[model samples]
Target: MASREFLKILSSARLGDVLAQQKLAEAYLTGAYKTPIQPANALIWLEKSYFSVTNQELKDKQTSSNSTTEILTQIARIPLAQTFQSPAFGFGWTSFWQLAHTKAETQLHLAAKWQLANLLINPDHQEIQAQLMEFLKGKNISSSLEAIAGLDLKGLQKIAKQFLQELAETDSPFTSAAKELLIKLQPKNAALSSLWISWLDDKNEEALLQAAELGLTMARLTLGLRLAQLDGGDTKSNASLKKAAYWLELAAKDGDRDAWYALGEIYRRPQFSGYSAAESDRCFDRAADLGHAEAQLRKGANLWRKREKSDEKVRGLQASYWVWQAHQQGIAEAKELLGKILESCPDPQKNDWHELALQAEQAINHHVEHQLDEDWLLLCHRIVIANQFHFSKAELLLCEVGQLQHEHCVVVDIRWELPKILPRLIQIETIQQRRALLAAGKVFASSDLEIEGNLRQRRYRFDRVTHWLTTTFAKANKHQTNTELA
Candidate 1:
């Protein structure tokens, strides 16, 4: 199926035409001229072409010691001089000594050395193992041995060990690569494990990456954390974040609690990997289930905040349940929130409610006596206002304040008639101040607030809100005073 032109070129190349040989090599290498892609055949033809050109050049030069010495010096400067030195050139060196009495340094000699080395390293050759050993012992051909270490051939463990021993004997440019190859070829062992850990402790990134790629869970998790902590907003930083996520996810799949938590944190930040609220929640929930205490508290808080916009009563219940779980595990913030939820339960007359209320009272007293700060006192008042209103917007405001702990001022406009002494609309900063203005209980204590709009935008009656606030604040004040006396 060969074209006439291709056959003509092949015929010319086989007849020792150097240009035709080079062209034929290119054709085979690239599968041009309707030739089959054959890398080995291409290297063979290229070597032939190179040698043919070198022979003609030598024939044109004067057979003088000075000329031969100049050519040898130039050959020594070839970038691959270290790679192309071979024991096969021993015959050529003897011939050179008898003639010009100088070391062999022709391009033909160099090309043959490199081509043979490349062919031996190409794993497809059946006798590569033997050839590799011979080449390693040959003159200045250690670079070829290094290339053999990089090949993914089976039964190279012994060869790799030899490389390690030789590399350890002296410093060389190939030492680091040799070490990596030896590690890859050898089975994982305690000594190697210790070595890798030491490398990691020394902040050797290449070693860490190699260990991670070898499926070390801890290494993967650590690398992920290191990548995630890289500070920047540039393209490289984003790429690092993605890579961090990949490793963290891998570790998490292997049940790494910290990886799960870190993944959750990363997913929550939109700039890092594009935010996915659901994915963030899922990761946090998984971490919490794995007994990550911070994750537990964060999951609970996220659920609690989401309840305001969610119409499902189960969502609020789950929020309380998680907060209680976190509290039982000794998270201070969760304990505070659990107490607030129990004490502010809408139906306090139920037996279950009464029991929870007692627990809440004890928890709140403990918090106030031991962990109370001025900021906490202000936060507690805000919580009371948010609970009394039972409006989504108010709950959102409380969530924001809890998260940020910044000063917030808001005005409530109530469309209802009130006593001249009572203000229909109020601008307030703290729940305690609102309680003071509604202490009379003439309006808010009697009826439920009429609210409208979606859950996030619902409004409430002025009297009903004030009544709830007055009752809640009074109970809180009494409980605190009693606890102090006790």
Candidate 2:
């Protein structure tokens, strides 16, 4: 018989008690309290009980066919069928594919499953190995047994081919996943074959640039690094650095703080013949504005590096803010600086550095669990508050971030842009017989920016912006949701 206490705990858990639910699940899983082994009973009870329990969502709202139909009905009532009708269905494996590419690890199991399928279909592909390696290297870890799984004869043959190629090029015999796979594939040949080194020469600038422009973030970082090296001072030195800086700027604009550090280096040298510290400071400030942890630390150090002691001292609070942000991002130098700053100030609660430090730490933890920080929300609020100003790009970003937050940061004013507006007009005009001139090109987002009747007007379209935001945040949401279910 189940103990009275365990039964009470399970009942409470079903009534929305998370801790109780966890305890009950653990008890059942472990066969505690002299319970007989009962996987079937445990699975059934846990599934039903957990579904009934109230829980916070960290992912996008999952759509069952039933729920999706209901949501579409409610949306139709808003008199904006065009806006309400979406192209893609709710979270599915395709969505999972898009998210795993972005390294948003809210749903490890789902991501792993998607990755497995991808590898299976395109076995022995170099691009796949490279992508996996890049993701792993960023995390400072190696070896993903989950990435390579048991397959049938055909699959194994394909895997063997791919594994041999990877091992041939990889340097470290034991540590390199590719090298290890090669051993498994061809034990005799593996010892005799020369290690592969030509893959390093696979840098294609045009492809990299194209990927960066399309918002493949790793591509942006890679392009930036390659440009930073100036790689033996080729004839294309200035062009290389400038292009690198531009891409880095875009990355920084997209909330990448490390890009700012790279920006600082590019702008630091007069010999590089680029922007000055003051000019670079703008980029750094922009980076800091977006919570780039290391960017914050470097901006502070940049002040001291330039011998701008007065400015540095005056901006101590701001510097400390970035320092704390850096510390939160795991920058060792920033952490040491923050420690020294805190020791000198000795304030219990109100120290600016201390407060910012706490906020930064909280922000990282929130991000890890697929939650947006309040600071990001405030930035979105600033955009919304500018309803009169109407920067469509800013509005689009708000909507994008809101995907994870579930309309938390969405501003209602996004309906004003020409890109968004033109579509609505087309839908309505089809209902009414509109003139050909009225339909000619009908003000598009790329139409123009102009002043109209005392309101500052700009042509904005949410098409690309909306798609980008949805693709990115939907993935994040799905990841979190899958994690919860797992």
Backbone clashes under 3 angstroms, per model: 1, 4
Worst 10 residues of 1 by lDDT: 418-427
Model 2 residue runs over 4 Å out of place are 1-206, 213-215, 230-236, 302-315, 344-486
- Please provide, for model 2 over 333-440, each residue's C-alpha lDDT reduced to its tens digit, 9 standing for 90 to 100: 886676544323123243323322233333334554646433342332322222212224434333222221111011123334333531100011111112211221
lDDT of 1 at 169: 47
**lDDT per residue as tens, model 1, 419-466:** 222111112334543442243122223423232223233223323333
Candidate 2 yields a Cα-based lDDT of: 0.44
lDDT score for residue 161 of model 2: 51
Backbone clash tally (model 2)? 4
Please, what is the TM-score per model? 0.32, 0.27
